[model samples]
Target: MSPKKATEAPLTRYRQTFSGKGSFGEYLDVSRRFGKDKEWGVRINTELLNGNTAINSNDMEAQGIFANIDHRDKKSNTNLLVGYRHLNIEGGARWFSLKAAAIGKEITKVPSAPEASKNYGFDGLAKESEGYIIALNHEQKMNADWKWFLNAGMNSNKLQRNIIGASSNFVIINDKGDVSNNLMSTQTVTKNYYAQLGINGNIKTGAVNHDVTLALDKAWHSIEGAKNMYNNGSMGSVSGNIYSGLQGNNVWYPSIETGLSSKDQYWGISLADTVKYKKAQLLLGVHKHNASVDSYNKITGRVTQTVGSDALCPTYGFVYQPDEHTSLYASHSENFDKGTIVASKYANAGEVLNPAKTKQNEIGFKYANAGFLTSLGIFNIKQANNIDVYKGSDMYLQQDGEQEYQGIELSVNGKLADKWNFMGGLMYLDATQNKTQNGTNDGKTVNGAAKWNAVAVLEYNPDEKFSIVGRAMYTGKADIYNEQLQTPSYMTYDLGVNYKTAFNKTPVTLTAMCYNLTDKNYWTAYGNNLILSSPRTLMLSATFDI
Candidate 1:
């Protein structure tokens, strides 16, 4: 059987190949205020959501609870806050092919299309995750010219997934959807902790007034898991037609084992100062960052690779407030952090690369008033790139070149009239990959980066009891492949309404929204994969206060 060359032709439409059984979500919140001046308060929030995803053969459930307490004392000029959150989730998993062909269109060229199913996925698959986070904030005034603050947080999460059998990345073969299945399961736990302390002081250098800040910060992160990575090569075959519905069977397969993986933490210290002279303000700062990473062999549980880096980064900016309603600004910044971990399929699998550095610069202006506000900006960013390089028979994942992104953005927001208000923004972007191997893709546009995008929203409030809103969003053409093909531009619209009233003297609010009002069919680009856009949806909600 020969593979169909359907994707070679321009993709005109994205066929919808996913369906969901149903979905539901709900939330509750409560708050209280106590203290002589009502400067102390506490709040609690809870949310739950469960549903079968639109993606065929996938379902998800999630729940979370959060609480926070805050306090302020005018006598000491101090404030404190503490918060905690817990969340859990369960879901199925799937992946997409790199081909740009429309979904369900691949199997149509085959002779056995009727019996073949366009939908492909796993049956004995399960994914579960749980996470917790705690945070603290404190601020105090040491004197009229100086103040201090502290911020701290910790987060932990665990994930357990059982892939009953592995499948191909959803591809069409000989007009049929074919996949190689294998058993795999893994459990991973990750933890992150961070803290920061800073002090702010007001000083005068001759005629210039300055606000200076000095800060120190540290962080720790680690990952541990059982059978962190696993692959059972070709345990079985799960094949079907791409044009028809392919239901997965509840067949359990044997499990396999791999190695462990971990990422160490990083720390940073910085100082910043803002100098105000006349109508101009200049900002300057520098940061020292250090980080490390480690990877281990899955089967041996032994360290296979380690990498670390230390660097000094800088930040600079200037703002000129010409008038009360208008201002201009420009800024530059740099960052460094741990690099990518090569995937198991790559020649450099389990290898940790050195830290990557990124730099950015921007210039912008803003005009503001009571009834309206608008801003325009241009920005440029450059970062090291990690790409898959074909070498002989095996693909090697390595750091190769630099990817640059340059863009211009304009936004407008605020009231347009006595009963009308509007908000919108437009952006034009040019992103390219440079300095690849042999310059093969030196000037190609980065995948999934749209050249132009815009959004506009209008709202009307005729009275205190009701409000209406309308919105429009547009995305221009984007590169879907390695500069070989592109996805066409698309637009979507939305409409919504809000009603506020008193129910038995209790304040109540109700909202209804219709998304993708026209039910337009479109395609979304995720990296190199082409995905069908979501269909029209309606949502309704109510809130009550007593």
Candidate 2:
């Protein structure tokens, strides 16, 4: 056998960008080939931000570096990747949770100034954070019809928060417009490890072809953390109001007490086979999964609880192609997930609950012709173990109910003409919570689940060196507090231009974009929490092929 031709030559690409909102970012990538069978690459990404609006002051910086080595032969390929990243945050850049009653008439905008946010010792709090990750992947081809692969990785993170504020007692606001919240601090160190080995092959029997896969995977996770609540079992028990603001508090103070320490491990085995004959393909699979968890009690200073569970989940799918440019498919699958560890504020703090189960079904179709692609899908998902405070009375995060979601999605992407391109998508969802304690929330729309969302983008290039792009985004009205309050539907637009040229024989591309073209104000919801959207902003960037 002769050596394969080299596909990768030494090349580097670098890009830098700055935004009018006081944010900067830089990216770099370099790749080269060693001989004819090996490749090496490195990537760097970093971002910096200065949050100095009229409301508060803060700063943030994030950086990451990644390197990989790839080697391939006629029958096997292996790639190893290692990465390191760091994050630093200073000042009041955290998201603020607002009460539904305070949404005011403007719907799109948050309450005025100090009413919406208050300094919570952010200036005096010692704020620092960092993370690191490493992984490895390898694959081998046994013969013309069979292959096997292995993937393994480990991720470790240690985070220590400053004097943090928890919405445990609800950051309260009185009729007189006074605002305050419960104070707390936390420190967490978590480590996760996973490994998987799999084999796949194709076999022909009679007039049908079968693709089979079998795999085994194992995962381990552990978390150790301490969270302290500074309230007297009442709302707004903290000393300072939104105006005065809490300051000069230590996250590691002796007054802080509660903690969580837990460990979890899981093992899974899966087998799947797809059979294809004529224009139809069918898939059948099953997964056997088991998990064990152990939680330690802070007061008892000992392992207090141990839980284990196992489940056999199945999946099936079918696809039929009636023509060269169209296909229809349907699939159903079941999954299981280990329960999350209870937070410090919950009555069952440090306890690991049982596993949650989920089931999903989908039907979709795809059509492609004439440089155009279109797809539409409808899906239904039912999930158990939705952690929530039941009836506003339970202190423990309980999975007393389930949630069901059904939605339809449609998308189209391709060329509209020789130099024009378009991409668009829309989705409509109907989600509800059920089986709650006393039916307090039964039949109610799930909070933060939007009913409709859509986006469209169009790009035009008159020549080889210049392009213009326009985009529009729309989000429908959504329930913020389970129908008690709803945010109004809103839309925003963006426009951008790109120019390309050669500098000293090196290719370069420059871009300028303006987001929120009409300076539209909007509110984004996250599980009953509301956040104001960014105003009109401009960003400029330049990329160089060095």
Candidate 3:
């Protein structure tokens, strides 16, 4: 290839095809060109889910297609893309059974004794959504000293929440009051539309460069929803014996003083700039965000609650390169979130929350050699008074309420030798809830905050057609439920192999994986309840390219 052709190769278009099958599902992907100058192309993908190892069922189907138009070599380079997707999910209700132990109470795994899992509330609940997106990107290189680009996109989606059937011994208790057999068969619909536009460019000076970008985005969403709670044939209170179940019951939906629907809207704008020189670079960014929600009382045709807020956030950073192979960097950044709506199990179910924010600072240094990279860093993140509806009443208030995570992270990646490659990282975090509330919970370690987390993976390829890989992971102890419960640290290992060969002049690859090789039983994440990690399982996959 000539110099110019070699440099432009990265920007050229190419065709791709792949198909694979595994325990989770089967998938097919394809992208090709068709049109004059090969300016137009299309991509298609489809995947179906049918198996889950947790004894819980996983059933779903996802499919997507996209088309693109390119004008990259023109004076005014441009690209346009449009796509559509459909996703459906159903099944997977592995409810924990409450039981009495010799010492106290315990939550048992899915049972086979009574011979049934009673957690499938309102039977076969499913979620289905259809989404569409359109985007356009344009760029211009007016001269060697300057370049600019513009990007715009729009996305829209419709969703359906479905519920049908009944379960035995249905009882869901959270921060809210006891909800017994209230989750019945019901359905809801939601619609959302989003749009964004951004413009960016860079200008070169004598020995420096200045780059800047501006972006604006907006979203509109609405929902027509209801939660159904119904009694089985006969429902009544437990006889103080969890082993025995309820006999009689009443089923009905709890009526709010007024029927209500949820609607929300958001808008945001951001600006960023960077200055780069031979040995150093400085960066700055800022964002202004605003959002509002309306709880429309359908019965009275009046808006019951109006919640909204606006805020501004900023970030700054600096990087210094001592040489071509090493760099030192420091940064301060901010995060702004609109927050999620509470689930029906909470007292504030379906209620809108004020925005949650966090500020973070970090310093790090990196070194790179031929085909290898290593980095080490330390950082702290402070979250503003956040809200976890599961922990408090309709409103969870912990003033000054501060939880902070301070940690050190190290990572290494790339080829270790001629026939070997590896990548891994280790992180140690001292997470604390400080100065947030009364001394009662002050200085306590945050629940689910693992003290240590580490992961490593290595791969060896003796030849061009075969490879073997191994991975190891470890985690430290953590507190749960405000430190009421504790979880022990755990480690796991995984081994895998891949082989590539030609079949009938077509390339084919096979992969086999053994996860949790020790078959260790451990807790993964703790929230409203204990989440169990996957047991030792084996998976095999095959892929073909045409």
**lDDT of each structure?**
0.67, 0.71, 0.61
Cα lDDT of model 1 by residue, 1-546, tens digit: 111112222222211111234656666666666767767666666666666554444556767776666677742333333333433323333343332342235433212212111224555456667787777777888988898988888888776554433321333333344533334455567788989999999999898998999999988876665553443443333445344433344344445343356667788889999999999999999999887777876667777777888899999999999999999999999988676776554556667765778999999999999978999999999988676554542346677677899999999999998999999999999999988778877988887889999999999999989999999999998874466556678899999999988779767778788778887766566655445555566666767765
Q: Per-residue alpha-carbon lDDT of model 2 for 1-546, expressed as tens digits?
A: 111222366667788887744667787777667654454333333333433322244445677776666677788877666666766666553344544344453233433324222334444343455666667777899899999999888888776554445544334343332444455455667789999999999999999999999999999998776644443332123334444554433333334444558888999999999999999999999999999988886555578888888999999999999999999999999998777678665656776766888999999999999999999999999986355453332345667578899999999999999999999999999989988779988988887889999999999999999999999999998885567667678899999999999889989999999988887756676666555565566888889989
RMSD of each: 9.9, 4.9, 6.7
TM-score of each: 0.83, 0.86, 0.77
| Candidate 1 lDDT for residue 505 | 78
Worst ten in a row by lDDT for model 3: 1-10
In candidate 1, which residue pairs get closer than 3 Å at backbone N, Cα or C atoms, i.e. clash? 116-244, 117-244, 117-245, 117-246, 118-244, 166-182, 258-298, 259-298
Clashes of each: 8, 0, 11
1-546: candidate 3 lDDT, tens digit per residue: 000111211232222222122236566555555545555444545445443433334455666666555555545667677777887766533332222121122332321122122123223345567777777777777665455666666666655443322322233232121233323333345666666667677877888888988888888877654433222323222221112232223333333222346778899999998999989999999989998888765445577677887789899999999999999999999977664554433444565555677899999999999998999999999875443432321322223466789999999999999999999999999887776546666777775788899999999999999999999999887765556555678899999999988779767788888888876766554432334455566777777776
Assess the local accuracy of residue 292 in candidate 1 as a C-alpha lDDT between 0 and 100: 74
Native-referenced Cα lDDT, model 3 = 0.61
TM-score of 3: 0.77
TM-score of 2: 0.86
Give residue 509's error in model 3 in angstroms: 1.4
